[model samples]
Target: MKKIILTIIYILTLSGCGLEQDSYLVRWWNGNIPTKLSDKKEKIWDICFEETKYLPENTKEEKEKADMELNNCLHEKGFWD
Candidate 1:
């Protein structure tokens, strides 16, 4: 029984370690505006877009700034160019 409990605990711990969050975004430019994004390459673009919705709306500037920051974060994590 003790061995079974230990095994279960070990399995749970390992599973938790495997469930990692994707926290990166890649970007590319097209024409005069930037286009394309890969949030950790998992196709979580909608989630990423939602997360960036807090940007100011005075101009496209705020959105652009957020995109740049997200791109940098992805690059630092070796997930973007």
Candidate 2:
């Protein structure tokens, strides 16, 4: 019984860790052209797009807005420098 409990705990731990993984890319557009962005500015924009995509579908509009703000912030922060 103890071994079974330990196995279950291990599985749960692994699953929980997976939840924190960042698999999305940020973008200025809704498209998934991650490779097209070569410059640092474009990359920052893509990161914004990816982050928005990772959010829940119900808040897509909000996420998109947030992504735009992120892009602006990146530019202001001299991402191209």
Candidate 3:
């Protein structure tokens, strides 16, 4: 019983670790993107787009990567603040 309880606790802890391990990019998106003011959204988006435009988006994975880079740029430029 003691070994079973410890194994369960260990498994639960490991599972919970990944649940909260979202990237900073994801956290910024989840916590800030929806609440951003409309007026500033355009300007900020323009900057991020320009910064990440050189990244290729020709494939699905490429597009996803570019999107992540764009989001990272947005987060760095105070989009999350």
Candidate 4:
């Protein structure tokens, strides 16, 4: 019984691990953008998604809003893929 409960809990935790389409981890850009040229882009991406300041509250709705805000910023800067 204990092993079964532990397995269930582990499964629940693993199920929530995923990357959203817009996530930097998912590589939204097309083709290979050299690291040299992508420094500024990387910084912006970090500020928008990786930084806690721009992440909004920890709620799902707040995260979605923040993600959209970041996507808009990237789009305005001419990054679309």
- Compare the candidates by lDDT and give the number of the best one: 3
| Residue 20 lDDT, candidate 4, scale 0-100 | 61
Model 1 TM-score relative to the real fold: 0.32
Order of quality (lDDT)? 3, 4, 2, 1
Best by TM-score: 3
lDDT of 2: 0.64
User: Which has the higher lDDT value, candidate number 1 or candidate number 3?
Assistant: 3
Residue lDDT tens for model 3, 36-67: 56767778889999989999999999999999
What's the TM-score of each model vs. the native? 0.32, 0.30, 0.47, 0.38
Better of 3 and 4 by TM-score: 3
Alpha-carbon RMSD, candidate 4: 11.4
Query: Candidate 2 has what TM-score?
Result: 0.30
Which residue segments of model 4 deviate by more than 4 Å? 1-37, 43-52
* Poorest lDDT segment (10 consecutive residues) of candidate 3: 17-26
- Model 2's number of clashes is 9
Candidate RMSDs in order: 15.0, 12.2, 8.4, 11.4
The number of clashing residue pairs in model 1 is: 0
> Candidate 4 clash total?
0
- Candidate 2 residue 77 C-alpha distance from true site, Å: 1.3
For model 1, residues 1-81, the per-residue Cα lDDT tens digits are: 999999999997887675434312211122344445555554444455566667675669977898876665545556543
